[model samples]
Target: MNWKIWKKKNDHKKKKTKTREWVDAIVFAVVAATIIRVFFIEAYTIPSGSMEKSLLIGDFLFVSKVNYGARIPMTPLAFPFAHHTMPLTGTKAYWDGIQWKYHRLPGLSEIKRNDVVVFNLPVGDTVALENQEPSYYNLIRQSDWKTVNSQYTITSRPVDKRENIIKRCIGIPGDVVSMKSGIMSINGKIDPLKNTGQMPYKIKLTTGNVNFEVFSNLGFKVSEMQQLDGETYLANATSEMIQKLKPLDFVKSVELYVESPSTNDGDLFPLDPKRKWNVDNFGPVKIPAKGWTVKIDSNTMPLYYRAIRTYEGNKVEQKAGAWYINDKVATNYTFKMNYYWMMGDNRHNSTDSRYWGFVPEDHVVGKALFIWMSFDSEGSFLHKIRWGRLFRGIH
Candidate 1:
């Protein structure tokens, strides 16, 4: 063979066009950003006052996936940036045809109590597209199932596609959690994290001519305080704020508003007549952990039926006064996954585990790191940005 023949047929390569170069750069950027979001860290914005004070509405923070491990997407096929629904189009952003098993990467540390976490709403599996705020279950509970179904378009979401909510993990796996008089107790002891949270207090003032400025100075928002009547008001305040308020002469008394256990809050978790648990007085229920077993009985069925039948994917039924799971006459259940109890720092205002029950392990997203930016919507133009909260580490 001639030596010239061995030479490259085309040594001169064609240069990329300006349009081609821009397209290539855009594609690379999207892929890199998606990878970073999926396996590293992701940005989240606080949309509600549920986590007030600890995490206020308009607070933008970064959630660290590596802290509690990043979950591999169960619904792998989806639009790059959109979550669940596509923007403007009002259509699905994901294809659930190719669903994958839940899997998580190795994490730096296991989730701990009081660690602020982002998790998928456990009750968000089924949703009425028209009314999603109260949740589909709540809608049915509020009215008849037929009425809800006839009025709104009903849809079901996979574990990963459900709505994401941020809250403090108050009860870890196997912890017996309960709330008495709005005071949460873990394993019969008062919650150590209670001080970090705030609740609605009935404030009896000496005069109706309240100095709203004084309360505002103690970090109370005008919107957060409601005047019930003359000389009485309901205010959401923290323990520290309550301490400071006690010294003020105008404050006759500031009493914590605890719901009586006897009062049947129709919206309470489990929704069982036997369990009259309310937000202020909830379970001594044990959180399910992987490999943990519990005796299946009438007493426990109401509390755990959802976990076994819904979250864990088991066919459960009761016949002849005996329980059957997956067509087997079973008297006990060994959980396949761990579960957690999450509650907002804004204890009285939040619809959390007290309303929906345990958050399964697969629902966990990540730990909130810090506030990168916080916006005050009602602030004056010059003071709009909450400068003090910028880059503040979340406790």
Candidate 2:
């Protein structure tokens, strides 16, 4: 009825509308950014030396999500009570059509060798990390880190007790990788291990027990060892030893050895075992393939239960001790996840695929596109920046 009052009311309505528009804009931006992260690129940081030379410690990288084709949102599961269900009718049978189908992504090709990749650790979870199998503890403890920097403080995340390592791919599925000295090989082809001579010395194994080495490379040592039968096989050895040993012989069982790793402060990582040599000393072994399923027996069972089946699916037979697919016993899937054998260019000092077996297929998350940024998890963020590695491409 009153013109002045009508005009005031209209102005109030316009203010409310503007507020809603701003809220909508903010929400839209957040959702759009999340979508891009889920289906496109993801950022990751390198925290360990396992992938040294290729990816330095503290180097941050952008991982391409679409490279391997994104796994369709199987219910788009998220943290906490979020899960897929019948949304409209309030039903729970939301995703019953094949339990989330996996498309091979026809347009996207499979992984190739020498491609730097990010993958989950071979273990599904760190469940096995609890057990202190001498070898298991050695592998974890020997990594160049500590639970606490000095005392009382948690140096890094406990769940990340094991390193989320970055390494260069040295082998792929169906490829026979061989290494000698610092050299590497695939399918009988050799990748010469360069003697960078930059490694340190720390411990040696005169007996089965780990002890400090008196000197450098001169001492007979087997660093980072695994038990084979009664004797201690070198965790690292030279290729000459692999070539010298007969099939299934002691030499075949023996691993490589180095002088030690305590040149500066051995506590940084595990002291070098008496065995300085590594895969280089051993004959080239064929990393198992996907179709080549094997019976879950004593020999193949450990690898099957752990490395193979941990990430993907496989049929297991009990007692008969055979595990395989399509009823084909005694072999493993050769190329389930496009295997990668990673190694640090610093051969003598690096622990890589030569110690651990082949990396699986599904475990691969993405390729390291470039180093966008870096920070020392233990040091001041600005001071610890590795400037030279910034903007560097991963080979």
Candidate 3:
């Protein structure tokens, strides 16, 4: 046996040490790939026509991950259980906060207004407090099975998810938004929509709720009324937006606010706040103050941040829940982060803040700088090329 082993060792030496080089190559490849995925580029595909014209169905693009800070997992504090560990073992350790590396955004400046960006979905997030004597199984059982028609109806999206969506940002923090005749306004200013070689037509400026459709991601329907231009914004215009744009005596008409809302000019208002009106209306309210103080009584809390904070995020502990703000916890609420309002350029088609309100600070993804490629799939893959939009920077 010893003679055989010696012979095998001598044979291996003669064969050369190519195995070590192969191992090193693999390690280097993995490290390089991880860096690219984490800090540089991310590939995403359009999920639907909701963002039609700008980002079409089947369109694919590379979104730069480092446009915002990269969330690295192997930071110094990531030691101990740096990789994996025995599940449920009390001996295991992990970092609850970002350790070693200082938390900071490394790429571009602050997220700007009118930048088509992506972020985490702020739909249903909540926390709960259990009773001292509560049984563990009961809590689990309650979560598993619940009343059928409750307001917090938990539903699931289909397994195949859309990779990414591209839309133009119209509003930002502290913008007073309202719509008239389907026109969009930010901070009392309406977007000055010029015919950037897009189809141009004369739009009527009527008062009150007039139903029209522009491109939008969310399918929004209704709204209330406020005055502008000469038209009254039909806040609840969903049921009222005439499915057909029949030049009716009663139905008001809206203009094309953006051939493309991604332009720098879109950031500026279309008309003076004192002049125009439209329902695809928006803004007149300030974005929620990040780190600002406030009271959370049952009353005011429901307006400003209530629908988004407690309503959208965790436990609605109706426990005479008089929450405190900052160092002052009473019946008041305070903001721990800033809030932003976003809308799609396709006003009539998009269901954004009007139905699903407020995008939080942490959810900011990246400023859409350019469209490396764009595709529109009317039928099959071979015919999906949208050649006109390729290599175009996000206006």
Candidate with best TM-score: 1
What candidate 3 gets wrong by more than 4 Å, as runs, is 1-23, 71-103, 124-166, 192-283, 295-299, 304-331, 379-383
User: Candidate 3, which ten residues in sequence have the lowest lDDT sum?
Assistant: 155-164
List model 2 lDDT by residue over 69-154, tens digit each. Answer: 65454334332221223345544433333344333333265667666766655432232222333333343335311121222211
Q: Which candidate has the highest lDDT of all?
A: 1
Sorted on TM-score, best first, the list reads 1, 2, 3
Alpha carbon RMSD to native, model 1 = 3.7
lDDT digits (tens) for residues 1-395 of candidate 3: 46765565557565436998898898898778756754676565666544544555566666666766653433333222122233466332444344242234476555666666765444322222333433322322233212112333232211111113455555665555665445556667776422121112223444445443431222222231234446533231221232333255664565433333222221112222232323344335456665555555543443453433332343333333544333344554546656677665545455456544566655554455556676654436775777766766655
- All models, RMSD in angstroms: 3.7, 13.9, 12.8
Against the correct fold, how does model 2 do in TM-score? 0.55
Candidate 2, residue 20: lDDT: 91
TM-score on alpha carbons, each prediction: 0.92, 0.55, 0.54
**Residue-level lDDT for 129 in candidate 2:** 28
Error of 2 at 219 (Å): 26
State the lDDT of candidate 1 residue by residue for 148-183, as single tens digits: 335677668888988889999999999999888888
